[model samples]
Target: MEPVMPKDPEVHSAPAAVEMSEAAAANEEDPAHPETMAFCPTGWLPHGHRCFKLVSSDRWGSVEENCAALDGDLAGAETMDDYNDLHTLAQFFGHTYYWIGGFYFQGVWRWIDGSRFIYNNWHSQNSASSYPCIALRGAGGWVNTNCGYSYPAICVKRAC
Candidate 1:
């Protein structure tokens, strides 16, 4: 299904992680304390206040599906610092390019999860046409692409 466009493109903030901590704290095998539960899910790696999971795929939809299944959305780097961190992580995974959450809809670039479109790392060639999705190059640049094209994805969500 195509993503729903918000009537007004307000910035989206990640849900607070305290809720996740509370949930995990309820599980006996899940650390038993809020402080200890701050880590990301078992297989996911942590950076700052978020957890990111690299899901390998050659298809954008598959990557979106995987991220949704984990109760997260595609990683949207709203700051240069975030882009740097995600870029570093993607490099470690040996990916030359990886899907992020931004996409063009109705001529506007908006994050899939509705986060603020506060920053950009676009390559000079990225601004050309109607490609509706974005991928981050390993060198920390972004390019637009046809949404149907395949690429690995970085799923991101609140840590813990």
Candidate 2:
């Protein structure tokens, strides 16, 4: 697949076209419902079971503290689709380190969340060997090491 790059950094993805017409009519009727927010699916952190976590908009603690401003330990990127959702949300926010599924255990690139990782790793890329957490770089369109790298990160919460 071709690289999916957004023209505008803070743009909300266009909801699927098939549902647009139906949604337009429904939108007029229920204006303030939770479903109405095009950008936020559930008004919950994940955004329609999509797994979106905001970092550092909270009081006390570091950016990790805000990791769960929307949810707690139960939060996680449930699938590749959900991780992709968080990735897009990171773009909208212009965040530095939107954490997703990647970790190094016994010298292997294992995904923390069991989703099939959807990223292209080049030879020069050195994340799994040196990073505790992974963050995607929009400019290079690659994931990189973030071990001990202090930056804002996104977290995920499971639906209860």
Give the TM-scores of the predictions, in the order they appear: 0.71, 0.50
TM-score of 2: 0.50
RMSD of 1: 11.0
Q: How would you encode candidate 1's per-residue C-alpha lDDT over 1-160 as one tens digit per residue? A: 3232111111122121223234433332244434434456766665566777777654566678889999988988788888888888767666567778887766678888776578888763344244667887766688777666666788998875
lDDT per residue for candidate 2 within 1-160, as digits (tens), equals 2222222223223221112234432322244665423332343332552334444322112444454344442123334554456556656656443444455567555555444445444213554544444555433233545455444445555443
Total backbone clashes of candidate 1, pairs 3 or more residues apart or in separate chains? 2
RMSD of each: 11.0, 9.7
Candidate 1 stretches with Cα past 4 Å from truth are 1-38, 126-129
Instruction: Give the Cα error of residue 158 in candidate 2, in Å.
Output: 2.2
lDDT of 2 at 73: 28
